[model samples]
Target: MEKVRLGIIGLGAEGGMYAGFLTDGKVNNMVLGAICDIDPLKRTMAVEKYPEIPFYEDYIQMMDSGEVDAIVTCVPHYLHPQMGIEALKRGVHALVEKPAGVYTKQVRELNEFASTKPELTFGIFFNQRTNSLYQTLKKLIEDGEIGAIRRTNWMITTWWRPQGYYDQSEWRATWGGEGGGVLVNQAPHQLDLMQWICGMPAKVYSKVKYGYQRDIAVEDEVTAMFEYENGATGVFVTCTHDVLGTDRFEILGDKGKIVVDGSRKLTIKRLARPESEMSSSMSMQDVMKIFMGHSGNDIYTEEVLEFNDAFGIQHISVMENFAANIIDGTPLIAPGSDGIRGVRLANAIHLSSWLGKEIEVPFDEELFLAELNKRIVAENKYPVNA
Candidate 1:
């Protein structure tokens, strides 16, 4: 197949954005063949606006209709793996949105299933991974430009949502419907990028606040601390209600520091000497001088690189790479298997918060599912307004 014929499930906000690009041929060698949505209004709009393209209320029918060679699912958090499995059953390629599933159980199942289908191209919409800045950061860290990493922190709270926004959809912020709040929704990009850049943490401890900034049944504020295998530490903080929020990702290593001040630009500071070498020469008297409030400023050098809004470009690049991989047998920048890491990270955080303790990576999946099930059952007492 020289050109990919793509079908989209879920004609909501995100799905519609993709449809616009496909409809207008934003990328090369790809055609938008079909769209699926259960809503009558969305189906009607698709039929009226893009009458040439096929429409289906049922995804199964769309998959079997032979209108598309691949499928991209933009459904609810829980439905991603489900629909992707169905797409695979149809012998079609699949690309799913972020936060692979509501919990690790579903994600593990999805990844295991995809692992059996070696012929199909399974991709994830981890669009942020396509950003050049993140690519540079990954390369720098992988190259040991900053030596051994000591600490990592992210304050990604730029997302702002009001109570009225949650009222618009039944699955906006409910544990049963949306799974969680800021972490699952706005923070997945950052979380995915975090693990992608700094490597996954060995353990996580989180303090989560449910509806602290709004009237919802899920957490809108979160602070999580992480411990790495190499004794490196991390902190992740996010909230959906912060005004003038910041998006700063800073990582410190034995050699220097790197910062991705997403609001403005990305920069790196290179140290003159390896921290191990510098500290080896220091005595207890040097420690006393630093303890007595003495510090030096000429420790490192700074370098700023070109940074730009990665919004639309990264999205298009994911689709482009997915097609390229399907056609030319290229490696994926963000494969479907890679998505499970972010899901596991989110699950570990929610589980840590629920259990009120430090949880290790590869935590008890059954326990996490049970805790989620308990909260899902409590959704009855706090029904969605819609």
Candidate 2:
């Protein structure tokens, strides 16, 4: 294809941001052919900025135009699956935003449909995977630098959202609207990163609290423990109500410990062992090089550069990948199936919280959906007058 024609659904914050990337020539081989949003105001706002492109209040209208080769679905959590399914059915590859869907069934359904339609490439925007530090960390773990991981802990209190933020969206905290809170929204990246680095957990136990910091009906705080199949243990704690912010991850293994603070600095203490004895008894000064190598600011810079390179000059990296996967048979950076795991983990956390017990892996999807439906009803009936 000479140029990948693009259509974007949902002209909200994320949609607008991605549109900026598109217009700025960050992604190559792509042209903004059309845009869609249910809210006419949002559509008008986006069109005001890019008046040359066609704007449609309904996504199907854009889809029917057959002018776009690929689609970017930045719609709300609940609509992701529906929009994606439709896009794939229409033979347009899709790049969807995070959490893919609000429920496990929706994710599975999307995955199943995408699997059958191998001609269409589906990707999720788990952009954290693009981070340089995370890439290095994943490389270290894969190369056995940590020497058989044992325990991992992440405390992410940094996502402190004010009450006004939640109030801004009707779907912010309601179960029927946005599903859960921190686990579903702010922490999906962390959960996805954890699984990406340490591997999927065999079991997950969690505790969640609603109304902890806001008037919302969903969780604002979540504490979860994960048991990995490799006998590794993990702890994840996140909240939106913290007075101060904290974003840190520490991984302990037989060889050494790796800690990453919010400052983006990584510290690795190589244990003195037989291998070290053969080399030398290195003090902190001797090991400083290893720490500094991993501590540099290259990762973040590299991530942005890569995204720009891939998307620049016609700005089609995301779209092109989807197109290539369908036409040229390229592998996706973050496939649709991979997106399901994070939501499943989030659901397990919610289930564990509701039952006050550790929930096992491969949770009963039906049971979770049923409980979520009940929560949705309660949330809808919540007294707005009170």
Top-scoring candidate (lDDT): 1
Structural similarity to truth (TM-score) of each candidate: 0.94, 0.86
Per-residue lDDT tens digits of candidate 1, residues 256-299?
A: 99988864577888877888886888678766765775644444
Model 2 spans with C-alpha error above 4 angstroms: 274-327, 381-386
Can you write out model 2's per-residue Cα lDDT over 1-386, one digit (the tens) per residue?
76677798888877787688778766665667788888868866876899888888888878888878778888768878888899888888777788988778888899999999876678887776766667777887898865788999999999899999999978787887788888888889898899898888999888788888789888998889999998889999999999698988988877667787772667665554433352456566545754677533321112111112232322234455555665567786578789998998898999888878888888898888888888877766432210
Off by over 4 Å in 1: 282-298, 381-386
What TM-score, to 2 decimals, does candidate 1 have?
0.94
Would you give me the overall lDDT of model 1?
Answer: 0.88
TM-score winner among the candidates? 1
User: lDDT of model 1 at residue 371?
Assistant: 86
Considering only N, C-alpha and C atoms within 3 Å, which residue pairs clash in candidate 2? 26-311, 26-312, 27-311, 27-312, 27-315, 27-316, 28-311, 28-315, 28-316, 132-299
